[model samples]
Target: MDMGGLQIEQDGQTLRILLSGVWGLPSAAGLDRRIAAIHAGGVRHAVIDTSGLERLDTAGAVLLHRLWRRLAAQGAKVEWPAPRPEYRTLFDYVADSGEGKVIRPPKESGALALVAWVGWLTLFFLREARRFIAFIGRVAESAAKVALQPRRLRLTSMVHHMEEAGLRAIPIVGLLSFLIGVVMAYQGADQLRRFGAEIFVVDLIGISVLRELGVLLTAILIAGRSGSAFTAQIGTMKVNEEIAAMRILGLDPVEILVLPRMFALILTMPLLTFYADIMGLFGGAIMAWSSLNIDLNLFAQRLQDAVSLKTFFVGLVKAPVFAALIGMVGCYEGLRVKQDAASVGRLTTRSVVQSIFLVIVVDALFSIMFSIMGI
Candidate 1:
């Protein structure tokens, strides 16, 4: 029967599709309806005959591919006759594309589905953990090599990343720390005033900020800021196929891209933590003087007497470790990005989340170790 620009004939269990005239964009709507209406029931085999076609463009090729898939889905084996060279190329290109094809897992329900989901999640987590460890090993190896041959290190890139991740982050980090200190002092003063120990707020702010909050908060902020930036930056490069090009050119992505950002964060995190500590104390001092009626001079003396070198160093020591975690997770997720804008966006968000989670977990482990050692 004639169906617009094509004809369909059934002989026994075999179905044949015949094409003629123009099958380009103009006739696409009619072609779709006619192709969809073809009777494939009880048919075991189908063949596409393209010899009668006068013209076929990309849109036509796509529609033809769709028809092939539709017939196959109905349990009929679809075959295409060899057409012109140009037709073959267009058909192959359209068929090979991943856009229109979707692979979905079989559906399950009830307890079995829950169990399967849990199993899948467990496997996913374990796989991700393995990859992270492997990435860390690669970074360590590259870092050792760079250390031995200092000339190979990208000092200019390191400094540039430092300015980007460190210098630019100061205002927000300092502002947040200062606000936290003010809130801490205000709350601590209010609580302690009932027992006539409003002056002890100095010790509270000094110990809490220096021993924990300063570095912890700074690392968290950096994870959300610079960590996401690293992912988006590298992810975009991957989407553009720049990383593959770099590999072809014999350039190490780890050395050129990862190390500079990681080392920059490592060097700058401690400085940022120190600055955070200072701003935190200054804010506490201000609050103490204004709310608790404690003199600024007395506040300074109390802060000096309360927090020791060990307390300050305790927080500083965690900075590099947190920085490494953040930078590595970001770059790792970025490198894992697929060649699409959606993958870039998805992995950038995942990088920030993973970096923050890892930072907190490591911080807790450090806290336990420090406590056990009585530091």
Candidate 2:
């Protein structure tokens, strides 16, 4: 305990101590005796001179803190004198944990760790994106080739999918879009009623539906439905060796297999988007009649003024790009499926997720372009 040989002295009845080095328990009795002697001599001011001290462990630091706190409770003022700059780290360590082992300042490591982590993520995403892009290229090429030779495109299968994609999907899309429009109108009316601006609810629903919500919702739904279906279909073909057989027969599988599905989705998405816009407007009309005491005909008239033909066209413009993204992802996933049932499902899922992400990204790009053109 007294390994550092603690010494207590007095100057004008003030207690002062010089810490020679590191101290510990074996000398606890001697240190206690020194403290007692200093207190008995009526020295209430104490200073710990640590300049000559070399090292102190957690236990030593704890002992010092307890003694300092104990003396202060008894009204003795305590002070610790300056030591080597190296001790600054030790003090900071003590400050943090009160484990009290004063440690030296730590050396700074270069920013390599942060940079390395970011680099790893960047590389991983880049690789995934490259693979997706390559798949899209193949899909587009196959689609174009088959399109050029109408004989290769299967009209029957194309028509079947168009019905499945466009007609079958209508009810769900319409229901969801209608509910969204009603909810938005109600919320807007509730807020706008404070300022007698309830009529503006018509403008909000009309403009928002025509420009953004209708297109975005339709894209998300198709991405989940058609995108996954494409991957699964293509994946099934791969597993069944149909794709391989077509290739072996010197036939471009892209034309016979992938192109029809791609074109079918592209042709159908815009029609669905337009349909959704009408359903949404009808929904808002219902909300206006129920909550705002506005007549359905009046609501329709207000919506017509706000949602012009140009607004509808801008939304229509987004549909083709969104549809193309969804189709491309679906076909690309279908093509990349390894020859296994499990691989087919996994690729299908990946394709749907990627397609949705790309759809949002492209939608944002369209929004920016429209803003730049002041449209």
Candidate 3:
């Protein structure tokens, strides 16, 4: 059987066209050739007979409408013979909806557009901050409840997340800290050698690594690694409607999901920061002994004299706060994900970026506070 076809005939000034079979996307190419041939004929007036059409769809209706408009534009009157009511309705709907109109973007001045964009961004930032604070409060309340009734704590989930976020992260964190220590020592030695202050390179390495670099770098790494993972995992759950199902089953997702992860990160961060400090000091010691003629014993002595317990505590004190920030930001972005795969990826990236930014800002604030307190 013929799938679809268009036939045209002309008698003097009037052109009669017959549409047959199914008219849809599959038949569009052939219909286009036929329409083009008819247009080339320069027929003045046209009548489209759809009574012969076995099936008509939006695609076919759109093509027919285009032909009608073309004829009308060229000083020709186009008419449609009495057809099935459904086909007529479909044709009229497609034609009158202005689907074929070209949409042009509105023009605006650069300065005005910039101002509008900035205002929108400021409002969005404020809204996000409010939502984040509310989420934190909910998490805190759930955590307090768990603390009062320790049995309610998801110990197994917390342990699992601890292994994933902390244990699994050690190698990368250690290696990066070690490398940073080496670079810092080498650079310090080079600068100090010019002033006959090479021995002070040990002081520089110990103070900087213990007080700033170790905890800060570790937090940044955790933010990128575990933070992004948390967002992606929860976002996937959101996309799959698992969160909704949990709610329907009377489960609080915050207690089950967010609190455990938050607790795990908090418990593990101080330990990780201490481990990073040790590894970084070891790396710097190696560089100092090899390059600056400062043996391991001499380097140890200088480090002991240069870095105080207060300096060590200053870095460790920031670890739990940084971990909390990373965990909250990651889980928050994950829960914010919409029901789409693209949203999962987008929010996961956003989680890592936002967590890192907030961690740095918080670290700077701690630095100011420490300086003021003379710690």
**Winning candidate number (lDDT):** 1
Writing each residue's lDDT as its tens digit, candidate 1 over 1-375 gives 222388888998999988888778888898888878876897999999999888888988988888888889888999886889998899889988853868688877788988998999999999999999999999999999999999999999999999999999999999999999999999999999999999899999999999999999999999999999999999999999999999999999999999999999999999999999999988999999999889989998988898899999999999999999999999999999998999989999999999989989999999999999999
Tens digits of per-residue lDDT for model 3, 1-375? 457788878898888888899988899888877776566256678888887788888998888887787767777788886779998899889978886799778999999999999999999999999999999999999989998999988999999999999999999999999999999999999999999999999889888988899999999999999999999999999999999999999999999999999999999999999999999998999999899889999988888898889889999999999999999999999999998999999999999999989999999999999889888
All candidates: TM-score: 0.73, 0.68, 0.78
lDDT of each: 0.93, 0.80, 0.91
The segments of candidate 2 whose C-alpha lies over 4 angstroms from its true place after superposition are: 1-114
Q: After superposition, how far is residue 103 of candidate 3 from its true place, in Å?
A: 6.9
Candidate 3 residue pairs in backbone clash:
none
Off by over 4 Å in 1: 1-113
lDDT of 2: 0.80
lDDT of 2 by residue, 229-331 (tens): 8888888989999999998999877777666777788899999999999888889889988999889888978877877888989898999889888887888
